[model samples]
Target: MRTAAELKYGEKGIINDIDGSHPSSRRILEVGFTPGQEIQLINMSAFRDPIAFSVRGTIIAIRKDEASCIKVL
Candidate 1:
């Protein structure tokens, strides 16, 4: 498994798991970052701290730190 943070821009993957104990995990889940969901790295900010993604029919942005806790296949 690889982390969502490792996905390059425009890359796509299926969510395998998320480290639920992480502080922001609940908010991530609430935004539809769940297992078996398809996610695509849509874009990144100029500094790349917040990365945009297309997931579960919506577009959301998350920081690299939070993205690291999400595992993908």
Candidate 2:
């Protein structure tokens, strides 16, 4: 498994788990980062801080710090 942050642009993976202890985990869940969900790395900022992803049919942007806590297979 690898972290969401490790996924290159246009790559896809299934969400395996998330670090629940992370403060943003709840917000990430609410935004639909649940286990088994398929997510695609859509794009990234110039500095690669906030990355854009396609999840649950919607495109959302999340920071690298938060993405690092999301494990994907």
Q: What RMSD, rounded to one decimal, does every model reach?
A: 0.7, 0.7
What is the RMSD, in Å, between candidate 2 and the native fold over all Cα? 0.7
- Tell me how candidate 2 scores on lDDT: 0.94
Question: Where is the poorest 10-residue window by lDDT in model 2?
Answer: 1-10
Q: Candidate 2 has what TM-score?
A: 0.96
lDDT of 2 by residue, 21-57 (tens): 8899999999999999999999899998899989999
Which residue pairs show backbone clashes in model 2?
Answer: none
Residue 45, candidate 2: Cα error in Å is 0.9
Q: What is the TM-score of each candidate against the true structure?
A: 0.95, 0.96
CA shift of 63, model 2, Å:
0.3
lDDT of each: 0.94, 0.94
Query: Which regions of candidate 2 fall more than 4 Å away from where they truly are?
Result: none
Model 2 clash count equals 0
- For candidate 1, write residues 7-66 as lDDT tens digits: 999999999999988899999999999999999999899998799889988899999999
* Model 1 misplaced regions, further than 4 Å: none
